[model samples]
Target: MPLFRSPTRCIPVALSVTLSLAVLSTTVAAQGVRTADPRASLKGGVKDAQQAIKHLELVSSTPKVEGWFNPRDLGDFGFANSDLAFQKHLVFQGGWHGWQAWDISDPKAPKRRAAVVCQGGQGDPSVYGNLLFVSVEDGGGRLDCGTQGVSDTVSAARFMGVRIFDISNLDAPKQIAAVQTCRGSHTHTLVTDPKDKANVYVYVQGTGGVRSPNELAGCVRSPDDTSTALFRIEVIKVPLASPQDAKVVNMPRIFADASGKVAGLWKGGDHGRGTQNSDRTDQCHDITAYPDIGLAAGACSGNGILLDISNPANPKRIDEVIDPNFAYWHSATFSNDGQTVLFTDEWGGGTQARCRATDKPEWGADAIFTLDVNRKLKPAGSYKLPAAQGSTENCVAHNGSLIPVPGRDIMAQAWYQGGISVFDFTNPAKPQEIAYFDRGPIDPSRITLAGFWSVYWYNGHLIGSEIARGLDIFTLQPSEFLSKNEIDAAKLITRDELNAQLQTKIVWPAHFSVARAYVDQLQRDKGLSESRISAVRGALDAAEQSSGGPRRTALTALATSLVQDVAASGDAVKVRLLSGVVRELAK
Candidate 1:
């Protein structure tokens, strides 16, 4: 659910009048009517209401882009907020009302498999094999999963923490354990050990208020109290063979200050040069763990820090950074190379229209950073949605994941009511939007606080969790910006399961598609002369058509010549990569 805030004052009569005008406009548009001047209808209204409606009816997209919207279940409450996890052809979507499992065997027409009704805010979920882990932070959550809700603060029926479920049978998921925490798990990251395959570790990041001592023993809220649990994150260890034994193994104070005061990190303040005031960093909002590289990035409230997770049980802070442009550190994503990190700022707590024309471009956007030779972070650049949204729409940079397009860093991101944006950031210094899908505000009369909560590329399609609408599926099509060969190359890289936070190195198969993808990128980036590119393409085509020894010899000769050309041009990276492809072709 969205962070609650006071409603804006408005006259009931004026709202009714505006709604009537909107209805009239929709009716007129439905009748295949066109006004003499389209801009005439948008002259005087409540902050571009007419223009917002026009955008809703006619959306912009790339050439062959197709999208499907799967509405929420009949009895779900509140808006959607959190990440999405996938297994095979199934998608698990979490909401404040509960979690739903959708069988996306036909992504164009997804069918709901199950709906589990459990009241929890920010029900972020992740899956591993047949196990599912959901974070529950709302105090109203009950142990029995009842709809009555909990009233007594100290009631034993109250349940807030991580809920584990056995999902072997999609139709009937059984709750196995509920690991309780001091602040309740707002979000959690799944970490696996290479040596210890017998168990999995979950780094629980809770951002809510602390539970009372009467409700949960030893939960102190005072910053002065060294024993306070508010400034630490919980690490839960779950035995693969016996998941019921899941329990908190460690509570590392990763936010501790120099004086050993865990609650004294990143005191909130404005950064003087008219920048936004920063939120106090008490706990992390999200953490992206690249276990393959033995590192993780934590997006704490006011600070972004890197961690050495060589020991999954006790992660140590390696470096920390602060940004004057960021108000709230919301989420983190790592580049495929693991050298760059992108952190999003949830300005206005994700409820206000921060993407309005008046908002600062860098305030609620992604701040890019690259690790120096010493493994310390250095500011690279920032990216925000280029399209301006109406004031009634709450838009800000939220959750997103990298699109595995072979040798590129492309991301499909969700920006609340700002709709979906797919952009290429391979050149971190100058990231640009390549494709987008946006609609008018959900309500023309006022703000509805609805849109995509998370959009991720899983399998071959882009799946998104819509806050008010439901599940959405999209596919990238060939356009001026993206080529068919590039799309095909991305499709070749598929996964059995996907969890956005757990970063994995993508390795495409050694096929002509992979080679062509690089060629397409080189053509787009203008890395080589057109005549040279044409010659290289001709050689590749001949090599692909030839058989056995002739094919190998042709590819080898072309590879050597291309390497020489690229080397002369001072592009050692491309030289080595093209050489490797030639070696594979020879094999």
Candidate 2:
């Protein structure tokens, strides 16, 4: 009498019904496994109606961390495909459809100031004061900034170079100059010369086809052409007083071999391993320059290089390393202390789901290395997104920057559709994820080449340049892993401007927030006993309240006791750091 038949039912009618259902279920299961439609095998349903079904939505630390999405819609332009630049209260969002200026004074409610309609390649932008530089490397780009596009290969209208703009007026950004190169500036790094205040330098790294001489003079495509710019990176000097006169000042052959020929560069081979083959080192994909230290880490096509940028105009390669696991050396990020560099490998070229369940964990991941006293790089280990993405997703390491968390080395990186993964790499040998933000696949049925291209921390907020979703702003929230005091300490470390490629050392003030950050870290690591932690906190609180002599005496006594305990516990590093803080308090 039941509405549906049960297998255990004694009725004859129920037994027949259950038998029929079991046969139907077996047939459906068999059909599903060997289905001809690829979409049928996908995680989500492939029907047009399933497109609206969201698998993963905005996931974060609630009110502590907030996000704002501004979809890309610059008339009829394409995807928002590259790096970002910040200046004052404005965030410049770049895309193939040109670029847009957003007023992020209120990160929660970002307002668009201006949107330029000029078509170009992946418009990777960098800002300095009132000057803004955008890289254009596609054949379709036009010199006139016209959307009509360029078809003739040798047309004078073709523009494949670094375009400089005077953004003094955000509403009307005027193109000041266009410095064309042999290839084109796929991405460029901004460098400042402390000795020379008159001009700044732009290391133009071209990673595309060589332009014809008819389009731009002095462009020789052949490697045999000794006069060609093919083997070297173009360095453009932009005069602060005369912005229009920005031109290529030097073409340093950093890749040249001992024989004076650019040999031994990656030659595109599997190197006898089952790993993906490396790309030929034609030009650098990205460069992270620490002007203060006069050092630069170049993520070339196949080689990861360390350069001496003492002379801003001519950077010389000091050390280079190759990894079998790396397919393409995509980008590099320096640790806050400058003792370590994390280089990313773009295994699938940012278009395929490299984080799939079957993909190797170390393929499209970050390679951490430590620098010895001689500036030689020593490989440590690797870190990748822990989440296994669906086949209909494009997930790989794209771009990221350090999250200035005082004593720790934490990074917020973009993993294409894998979303933003924040991890702690304080110990290069073992890196672990701390926080993350990801969305469902753009297409449930077919793979869609869309997601975050770059996620960088500028000032206080983590801004991400989404390829298809547009600009996304995120703020860190307090969790069991990260305390409010630590977040406050990170926010205290601010910058006047930020470019992900330009690495800067982060220094925190000797404030209570900083002391609490260290305390939080100690608690998380279980480095100190509960009683010791309480004593340390009590001493810090008392020292903050007291003034002059009393504060100094209390801090020094606490530091001496902590040092002795650390010595006994085999924690010399912690003792040194605590002693340094005590000295700061004394002053």
Candidate 3:
């Protein structure tokens, strides 16, 4: 039987799922959705499964493109969908069998506009203007994007590292450049220096084993070797005017200690007998660069690092922290204001189930940290999927992006088969799950390595890269926790492009939605008195209905009244914010 319960329930794409990983063995099949939680015990299937959604609506679920998935096994690793990149009205979703471009102009019905067939394991991509950069780390990757794997121990035919494509024409993307690296680019982050607009920097994060010197000269790795490429990240400078000439510029040893030792970071091994054994901090699995604040949070193999990327070419490590509960530091996401950073731990490497009943909540979870003025990191708490899933589901904290909810630190994260969770982390010490959408399992009778690889918020909707299923798009629905005003405020913040690794600051305009969002937040948190809240809402409604002088006068009067309310309000900051937006609305 076909192995997939992904897009089967939704809309079917071209070509049926022909790949089969493992036949349904009665013993290895998913057992009962592990009904530890009474609220959710969804049935499982690769074609059709029971879904449990809350406060989020699935706008569309597109199946894998025809040629991309002749996946040999059930896990679908060879050609699984990877990370995502957005531009214009199209979403560039990376897949091992090259990447597919989906036109999301109408998110309700996303259409596959283009596909590039490049055989690689993890096709993480980032887009800047007309250039689309993809990470190629597969040993079989060819220079010409051929399906035939290169079997040479040392041959010029093999290509590894970052590939730059001119996506000026989406239907027919042309490869412009391929900058080879020592270990290949497992993932890369696009960074920028406010001082330099002529060029953008790509922080090449390679976690794969170092290539032989013959395969790629200058590539060396040894425990005692001083010139080893193991402990440093390669930075490629892509000139906007001439992206085809992009080349590796700096290989900063950000892990070095005060003694100038390149291998000064975590040396690997478990912190204690009960702790999760972690990998050594040699290379970064991923890096989230918030160029707006000159900060980048790197989830290195063994350490969660903070880098000062003021000089995009040469990032300097400002601080580093390690968690005993973490098995692997996989990815990071910074708060909108850069005051907080959340790092995910990919315990089972996104393959095995880590959200089982025996699993620890702290492991394979997201560790939240507060960044003080001195660049010091203080651990706040950790969050994992609240409900325990069955063993058949390979679930763990994978990839996610921040939801621009004005005053809140909310994130929409993918937990493999555990599903997509939207949580509020404004209070790092006490993070809470506000919304979630989870399907049972791929097979109720077998273990399958499939689910969301990465789910990110871009423009106004959440776009997810399902490992086996395909592209999934979702829109936030207003609930008690997330009000329509807040959702509207978030939608007001739009972007031309979005690369979760390279975060763009969310700036909401001076509109009535902004003021209403603040008002909703105030009422939700009991920040304002009910009498005052109703009065303010009435004033806002009157102002919104009027025009010109009448609206301005009404808004100004409300803003003045809010100044007096702030004295008695519990959440003065948000009240002040509401008043500020009200004043702006009047202007």
Candidate 4:
């Protein structure tokens, strides 16, 4: 399968970033600060609302397919869109019903390939080659993909776990396995062991209550029951040769202490005066596994944890941290280098207006931490949408992914009705917003529960999974904070598959645009002398116009000069990166 935009990716183009940046900067660690900023007050409607965008352009706005939604009640909880996963040119979108495979081969206009309708509140989906797994936690879920749900308190017809489907035939997928757990899977991470090829593992997070003994056979209602499905995560092993035999292999107590107390983490309570009461560290809401780095970040109820996953089936807790301002640790994202982690606090449960004029900036925001040589997480900084939203709008930090900008830690995040915010966290202590795209509320009279649940950068577009509206695709435009060279360089780093929670290493090819992106960064921050910057750009432009031999010779010379500038430049790390890219291009 050829790439979507590879035919002319290396062509010569204009690259400029000389404008002074007015980054959206503010100390997000402050509390009890408010102002009548009057944001999100534009015109509103279900489909036709005023949009506020900065350094971003919407390429397409696709609505839900026929029979998939009810227009009369757009905010219907039973039909809300959830998370997303990508493989090749297809995006599998999960919802309350089931999952839909979207053909983004032509990204401007996505087409629906196939659909599955199973009655579950959140069918969080993950894809690995021809295998597709959808989570089932709602008690109404059934074995068959039936629209009518099960009403019995305990019935044999109910299905509550992870469902594996053979999606080799997208037109008619077949259920391969239904691995049951004490509590159903709210979300699961697809993890691959570097040393194992015959099987893959899934770290299942069951946040819902446990099932009855009659329904699942191993679940109890008592909170103090030793066998209760809490304070631990279920690990399921799926053999590639026989996926039908997938079952629970281990339930590691990732939240236990040195003495092996299952409930060793924080109990539900407030920290001090005027603080919010946090939930106990019983079940994890989400887990992000970076197999390439042998580490995983767990966003448990009351604590943010780090796990050593050298053994995929048996992950051990290595470290944990807590934030006084965080009410509930909802999700986690790691930097590309695996040196830092960003955790989100889903305050107000992501449905209330947590970004109001009187709300504290540190309440429902992102807490960033840097990892030391000992793998301990130290507080770095915090970031929140530095804007006030209407009371009727539901806004807070939700799901987001790191944009593959070379030499920078940039992210495009979702904030419910507050909109999508793209920020730069290269300096974790001073994360700043670079771009954003927001829409007015669905209805101004009352809350509509319509906003972007998550936004991710895939191939070259920022695709968003909106709760009320359908899919939205956007491309980051060049501005003072970002350059065309940097955006093009990011596009060079493509992936065959993307399960955002299961992060993989990002590798850029030996391309001239990659080198230019680094050069543009130096110019933006004044890291190098003006004369040196001009000379480097001229050399790159000249080399790009010449043939193979001349281009190599010119690039080699430029690389030698870059190596010398590293000692004198203000940003030694960026200079080193630029020199490395130039050397790779010469080779």
Candidate 5:
């Protein structure tokens, strides 16, 4: 079975129910969508478990081309525009300050057209119109690694901020401006104001790292000194058409309570958890903005915050949700209707950083939560991934988005190793899985030769990003398309004939059906290849006791032997089974 529901964590994502169902309505007036308005309140409760929506659909999965991406890690995903049907390109930064853009117009077989390499760490890419913002930070932005110590240089370059690029040219994107706001820029988001004539705003935020050597001396800070950046969310306004009008403003004050402390309630105290004034720094990771509503959502380290950016220069936060369970809230996305917001956790760091000795959860430290935003942001319900119970240390939900379905009540999301899942959210509290595709276990010979990292829809096709592998493309069969031609009943085969002629290569619309096909064929085909199977089983048994397993080498030879047996008997079923397992192991 596919991994769907996730484990529980400490947090809330939306509004309380006393307000009425109007809060969940998708109606929009001149002001904008009702529930989305910063002034309007969001009200709703977790859906009941018994109300699980039914008939989830799985279009297809193509694991043959997984080796294309060939990278160690994958970060955020950005589309050309909020309404574009296909992604224009994708950018990622890590290991080496690096960036690459692909012509994803062909989502399944995207080609890398251009790449920019940097030395320090480069994070997510934010795009607006023709301009792109790439975050860069190098120990104070200096080019001196030999002279000053590496740590000191990195701390000094707190000069980290966004690097601007002019992507007017699809083939050759040029760098138009590199703006530095505050000390460092960790992640930035691009916003466009529909009310204002084609105007854009860039919110460049920083992860408060150690600034000075004194603070680095001991991981402790003087509580009286309010310089710890852990609580600040900076805003830098940049005109989309005019680059010269750029200006930086401190916007964290909007979310700051009367005492000047961020509304977020901290847990684990200041010792291990970094406080703004403490020697360590806090992380304000990813933020998503809905310009039409003058609302922006932030996935802070341990909390989720909502800000009102109606006054571009002076923003105000109307509500917030905190989860002490998740070590850090990493990414978030709003439903197309804007009534619900989905949040995910980056739990890997908590187990390693805090040094908790308890066994981790099976799907590891990842979970998905839904929030209601009518009156104020409040928690609606939550779900966990990987049905198994133990901690999933590495495989986590890094970044995900909800597919826009015009009138449906279900939602779809992608997990790194968990593949993609489409769920029915009519019962928001107990969201049940309708469809899923796990990459299965890691196999060297599988398509791109890596784990599935990112999945998005482009040009009506499902595009998957497999780091250290290539892209895997899939789409609904021609017969599944809504506009497909209707077939006559006379051409269809009977159930008995279909069962008798069942073949391994027959493509199915769902994963469970696909699994059943393979399992059934395996049982039927085993009877006809008893001698051949016995030989391979003998080799596998012997290899298990050998010093270095020769199972793969033996498997290839066995597959070659089966090919001959199939050829002599004209048995395609045995050939397909032997070939798939052999290809996976031999590679």
Candidate 6:
């Protein structure tokens, strides 16, 4: 996760009267209003035919050299409409190394103002006040939360959990204090209570770390430890001056009801480990707090969790939502109105969870879902990426925002191959794509490989984290046409129905033996042992056993070869394999 970027980041300013005069000058120039001017007319009203919304404007794109941690998420303070002297900056995790800040005052051009490198570099980041609290997944390679194969030689500095940085100064953000309290910090959010200043708190969710040898049966001291009960979401009250005041609070005692029996503890410590309301199911990946609602939502890997933080010192776990469809929830954000919670699944990047190829976007298993906290954390709706574009090895919408753009109804989302998409979620159940900017020259087929990590609307400007590149900024060009039917009928269909339709539409070529030969050569050349090679061969055989066996097998072989090629030779694989592992698994 050590990407080519820096860390921790934000700001305010004014020459008093001079700033006021400058703001007045700009406002007077903009015809007296602060917001972007509305279009004059809707020339062609809504019609029976669907109108295409086109993408306009490429503000700026920077190619990151020594990338920071993988840019996991992005956020803006008041850079949109306010006349803050130095517009708010963008705060993101530089891969796993630390936090990186960028100055985006000029929408057309952005400057990388600062980078804050800290220990335990991997995890999601969130900003509050002048402090940037990052939930670092640094457990000293001690826990096997899932990355069992990650090299043990990576330093502990890369695994220190919850490194607090003082980002008050934009130029040289300092790591004032470091806390190794949790086993591993997945993601944390700062909860600021306007009602009581003493109530401000930080919630850090630690997805259970590497299981101990005693816990995981038949497992040695490897990374894949499932038995360790270290997974928990912590509520620590913070003092304005020192992070040392951070202390864990008591959580609702939740226990795992395995087979109707109280078997284990909830994942989030006393919240119940191996039980019905266990927050530790897949490990807490994100903790989003809406202080306005006195609520803190945890995006557990396989489940969604909600907690009432009215009493920050001792939070209460109220309800939990579990959807088996998505197994890995990466990030969570509340809507502007603070009624709806949005969760993004990080499933499409060619891992076991999302095994699709890049071009075949159907297999790209990422999804955008909303839960209504106002109604007891009930799931309000969900919208998955349409499967018509084929499957992608690693494409899916990642960290995004419910933009405040008037009449746009667009939620700016970071799609790997899709680049950045502004979708009309006017109808929450069905989202319409209004505009999209695909990353230049990147294989669209491999859409889940962390191409664009985060996308957020900062005022009029749309900021995106292009993982392969650096930060990208864009301006939304208002479109005159209104598309009523951008929502595909296919997307509304049930998974079974979609699969039924795909059975006929997802056909492969009659012959791919030539490509198969090349794959064999590669396996041999790579010196894969007989057993490992057989494992691959077994995959091909297993795929071949499905309905579209021949096609699926050939596609699997091709994709496997392609991924191996890309990993080994750094060559782009342009192959599409919708009917491969994804379709086969669906069957």
Compose the digit string of candidate 6's lDDT tens values, residues 429-451. 44556666653323322323334
Top-TM-score structure, candidate number: 4
Models 1 onward score TM values of: 0.88, 0.86, 0.93, 0.94, 0.58, 0.57
Clashing pairs in 1: none
For 354-440, candidate 5 gives per-residue lDDT tens digits of 111232331123333344435365555554442221122124545544432222233445444444545545445545554444433
The residue-level lDDT of candidate 4 at 522 comes to 94
Backbone clash pairs for candidate 2 read none
Query: What lDDT is obtained when candidate 3 is compared to the true structure?
Result: 0.82
**Candidate 3 on 357-425: residue-level lDDT in tens?**
777666677777787778887666667787788888988888999888888899999998999989898
Q: Model 5: runs farther than 4 Å from truth? A: 1-97, 137-159, 181-183, 208-224, 262-264, 267-282, 350-374, 389-393, 440-452, 476-587
lDDT for each residue of candidate 4 in 345-413, tens digit (9 for 90 to 100): 888777777888788777788888888899987777778887778888888888999999999999999
> For model 2, how does the per-residue alpha-carbon lDDT over 188-301 read when each residue is reduced to its tens digit?
898888889999899998888788787778888887767766767999999999989999988898888767787446665654435457666767888889988889999887
- The C-alpha stretches of model 1 lying farther than 4 A from their native spots are 4-82
**Candidate 4 — which residues are off by over 4 angstroms?**
1-26, 29-38
- Return the lDDT, model 6, position 553: 56
Identify the runs in model 2 with alpha carbons over 4 angstroms from their true place: 1-77
Candidate closer to the true structure by TM-score (higher is better), 1 or 5:
1
Ranking by TM-score: 4, 3, 1, 2, 5, 6
**What is the model-wide C-alpha lDDT for candidate 1?**
0.75
**How does candidate 5 score on lDDT?**
0.42
User: What is the RMSD of candidate 5?
Assistant: 20.9
